[model samples]
Target: MGGPGGWWRRKSTPAKVETYTRWSFHFIALSEPTVIGVTAFGHLEARAALLVMVPVAAHVALAMVTASRALDWTVGRRAQPLRLLWALGAATALVATAAVVLGRHGPGGPGEDTGTVLGSVFGATLCYGVGLTALGLKDRRRVVLLVTGFGAGAGLVARAAGMPALAALGTSAFVTAASGFFAATSAFSIWLLNTVYVLDEARETRARLAVAEERLRFGRDLHDVMGRNLAVIALKSELAVQLARRERPEAVEQMIEVQRIAQESQREVREVVRGYRRADLEAELHGARGVLRAAGIDCEVSGETDGLPAEVQSALGWVVREATTNVLRHGDAKKCTVTVLRPEGRVVLTVRNDGATAPHGSSRTGGTGLAGLRERLSAVGGTLDAGEAGDGEFRLVAEVPLTARPALEVAS
Candidate 1:
């Protein structure tokens, strides 16, 4: 359990964006009904307003469901909502027809106030329905055609219901503009959500590529170190065998040379492996900054790696690497700061990041990654402490005495 706010905090950036976009569509759909209800009540008597409200509310509800299903289809979460779209279209036409009838023959016999209120009902219901209906369409040109057709239809329908030519034209214009606006907004939201998912995937890919590149480099180094030495050892051993078969005295010297070369190869291989495993403190700091910035996180690094013992630097370099990895893997961090300082014969390294949430938990308290880091630090007599730092921040601190030596290796 990640506490009270766990559910939302645990969602990744893409999930959060999707949730926000979906709810925003629902809220927009709800507004159509809210506005119509309020306008009717203000302009008409209670009985007439109630009459207008019922069909309009039903139309809005259908539009909302259609929009939800359409979004699900757009994101590949569900099949195309063809039936729901057809149902909403039919409901919108029926509601608009009813509003036009009410306006022409109202309670006070077709007065201006009654006509005004019902006309708004007619236009709003038609426009919102057009917008939600457009969501099921993927082609931009098709959406444009749909909105244009509805605008022209609104005018023809109003004219047939005995509205003046100018008022009908005005209704057509209103539906066109409003419907197009809502449709464009919905399209943009879907695009933005997809882009967020793509960018997150690219970030993960870049991290994997970095690891693969390092492995290739290590492999190349190992081949270069061992290839020539192994060839020399094989040649000398064959030469010694041939000399001994001929009863030559130099066979002993030849075998001694082979042994010496074999021992030398062993020593060279150890050095190559050691150099590959060693992490330079300066290089790690620069790398951390680059990697974090590439992921769109603002990273600030302060202090120096100069004048530090090699063993101390190696241990802290690993701390920096592990800390940087954790920042990328967990949390929706925006800014990360790393600092190194020396005071009173002790070297200290600290990494801190903001946008920490409770659900992801601290990387320090549990995980094999951090446990391995703790073991590395212990070898150099260093200590690591990590936890929340208040105001939505997580911090990790590592400290080592300057005079600390590497732990002695145990003989196998």
Candidate 2:
């Protein structure tokens, strides 16, 4: 009842179409022997029919095994032994089928007729071809040659055994080989199509992972930029309230400073949110030295951050910034050291601070800043470790490969 365009509209997706095609070939492969058995039923006596069943069943079983091996090979697994076994089985089944089909009509007197013998040959050849093609051999030309040789040899043997039509041997051999060739190539085509589908899905999965990683990076950056500033703003606001209660004139200045920091923090958050926040290694190092010095803590930075990739610098700069923030906000330190070294094919950044703080649980364990830094480092094939060092010292170490994978490239 549907029009011509209706079929087109009702067509399934490419994945569904491929699945249907694969199953269709499987159905053909599984039913080929049955179809051949049914066609030769009327001509075959009861004993002959039973005899043909042996080779037919073996052929079907070998075909299934061959297809399984081909799939294994397609997915990059070992299948050499199975492929060799299938080849031997196919040859045996082909010979058995040909003999059973031709021998049914006695020695002379129109033995099994030419048409029936050729039809049986064609079906057996098709089964062998499909099974061989599923093997996914590298040299297709060799497969073609092998199929042709087998088909021709079968026809020659039939002619030598005095089949009815001797003149049609060449035609039957060519037909048998051609049918086998087409069936094998068709099965290979289905395998290739399914492989392409798998690659496309893998690409899609990588794309999704990229998007998710970018989101995480952005979130981490935002948290790192806002966490310390918000904490400082809260402390200052509290002090300003205390001063205002005491009617101190310094309350106005403190409130103004708090407002300025708040506004700056807001702008910085926007930069991070827009993905335009790139931390400068030199700037972070200089800032850390100055801030620690201002807090009466001796800070030493030993590193040459030049000649580093922008992405690498940005990632390392974030680490320095977060480490500095944690040192200032959490630890009572007398001295802090930041060392950056490029050894072999790696960039190592270590921030060690000697602080006498008891093991009072801090956000470094599950803090957003350190956690985000970890994620950022992971995205660039880097690692981060932050914990208490011996003798009341906390250390944060981040290491990234010098030839780290570019952020734009997705890892396979």
**What TM-score fits each model?**
0.61, 0.52
Worst 10 residues of 2 by lDDT: 356-365
Candidate 2 lDDT score at position 34: 66
lDDT by residue (tens digit), candidate 2, 1-412 = 3797676557545445555555655565667666667756666665666665666666666665665556556545665555454574465446544653455444433454434643564545454544455355555675665566555655665566565565447645664566566547755665676677688788889999989987876666667787656756676778789899999998898789779878978888888766677788898899778756745689999978889877788889889888877777776889999999999888999999988662234335577777777777887889998878789888888998979786642111
How far residue 41's Cα lies from its native spot in candidate 1, in Å, is 2.1
- lDDT at residue 227 of model 1 (Cα atoms): 45
Where model 1 places Cα greater than 4 Å from the true spot, the runs are 106-108, 247-412
lDDT of every predicted structure (CA atoms): 0.79, 0.68
Alpha carbon lDDT at 206, candidate 1? 99
- Candidate with best lDDT: 1
The count of backbone overlaps in candidate 1 is 0
